[model samples]
Target: MKKYIKPYYYYYYYYYFYMAEKIGIRTATIVIKDNRLLLVNSKYSDGDYYLFPGGGLESNETIEEGAIRETLEETGVEIKIEKLIHINEFIYSNDWNKRSLTIFFLAKPISIRKNNLTDDGGKIKQVEWVDISKLDEIDIRPRILADILMKAKGDFDTISLNHSVDYKHES
Candidate 1:
């Protein structure tokens, strides 16, 4: 005799496996000068929240290549990645359900030009150099991103920044 499985059970099983198999990779840069960090205010869904200039890695792209592409795309500044800063992981259960692996790197700006940046959806936004001392006042993503910056100032090798991707979401 064959056993019958419920449709909802199959649906939940597929959902779990789908979430587990889906993986996202991103690259971000730390561009600092004097005592300020270069950040961009995204005008998209997370408007007002400050974040480093970088984005998801395209298919068949190296982490470094994605970093360069994203930095140049987000900010009008060309950058040269210097060293690996930290690897961050975040999970969200909102519209897009999955986890993301963000690779942060320390980089220097090679050149800057007059231009503007927009999200993949064409949301024009402003970019600014934020003083590290005032980091506490701004609403930033991956909250721990700030802590990582502070730790980097010292001699910390690796930091386990635990945070939810959709911490800003009201679910």
Candidate 2:
């Protein structure tokens, strides 16, 4: 003889796994000066793409501190975070284990160290300031970001929950 289990037990088991899924926290700093945006050309498995100066946040650091550290590491630019502009939730359809919560901050440049560009895990190729108008012509991940920035007239109160294959996860 076999014992019978309630159907609701399976539901609870799935719910527990779903709630235990891990999420990675990321931070990006949007530093604009003289009508140009600071971006890093990062190399990936596929190719190179332009992205804002930011990266994964450490457990001990706050969001603002993470943004500042990432910017300095990628662009050698010291910045003071002004305000939180956008919060982007990115999920990969190919892999349910990969999820990211990216916090975007508007920051002001405090100083730029000359000839001190550091490598971010050997991903960043070159850090340069790109004209805001030319963003459409470049290869930027999450293509919607270009559209958003173009329409943004210094206001950044947007929350984007995008689930698209356009963003590639790091291997």
Candidate 3:
């Protein structure tokens, strides 16, 4: 049963949606524990992809606050964000135009509140603790995340950030 929505509400909804499409800011956390990293596995019609535990920054929250909040929401674990790893701007579009500057952070989980993955409204299917060495076997996005993690304990302090990767086409 479809409920009735007023004309003004529809205008508000579309306006908000348009603004969200214009500027999308996201965050990703690198949580390493017991020689393993936490990851979320997502299955879609095109293929499967793994995401680090993180999400969009809220309107009134700082990047660190959003990182901690999103981590808990997606993984059911409380986290303490330690340091920023990198800030990269990714420009890509599918149906709707989407350009997001993703802030990657190094964080530690304070406690595991739940053993299973929490509801991401069906976006994520499962959560797993993957061994650091086995990241080669899975499909992780940004393509540089795993490498960035591997260098964390070494000279991560010297890594250059704000590198832009353009996936936009020549259309």
Q: Judge candidate 1 at residue 101 and give its lDDT.
A: 83
Clashing residue pairs in candidate 2 are none
Off by over 4 Å in 3: 1-21, 93-98, 115-118, 151-155, 159-171
lDDT of 2 at 4: 42
lDDT of each: 0.74, 0.79, 0.74
TM-score of 1: 0.75
lDDT of 3 by residue, 1-171 (tens): 245567768879888877556656888787878888888887766567888888888789998999888888888778888888777666665535666777888888899987644576687887789888888788876557677666554345653465444644210
Please, what are the lDDT tens digits per residue for candidate 2 over residues 1-171? 123465567768877777556678999988998878998888988988898888888889999999998899889999999888777777766676667888888888899994677645788888899888889999976567667887885667765544444346732
The full ranking of all candidates by lDDT, starting with the best, is 2, 3, 1
Worst-scoring 10-residue span by lDDT in model 2: 162-171
Residue 166 of model 1: what lDDT? Answer: 62
lDDT-wise, the better of 2 and 3 is 2
Give the local distance difference test score of model 1.
Answer: 0.74
lDDT of 1 at 140: 68
> Quick one: RMSD of model 2?
4.8
**Candidate 1 positional error at 152, Å:** 3.9
Instruction: Report the Cα lDDT for candidate 3.
Output: 0.74
- Candidate 2, superposed: residue stretches over 4 Å from native: 1-19, 157-167
What range of 10 consecutive residues in model 1 has the weakest lDDT sum?
A: 162-171
Backbone clashes (count) for model 3: 0
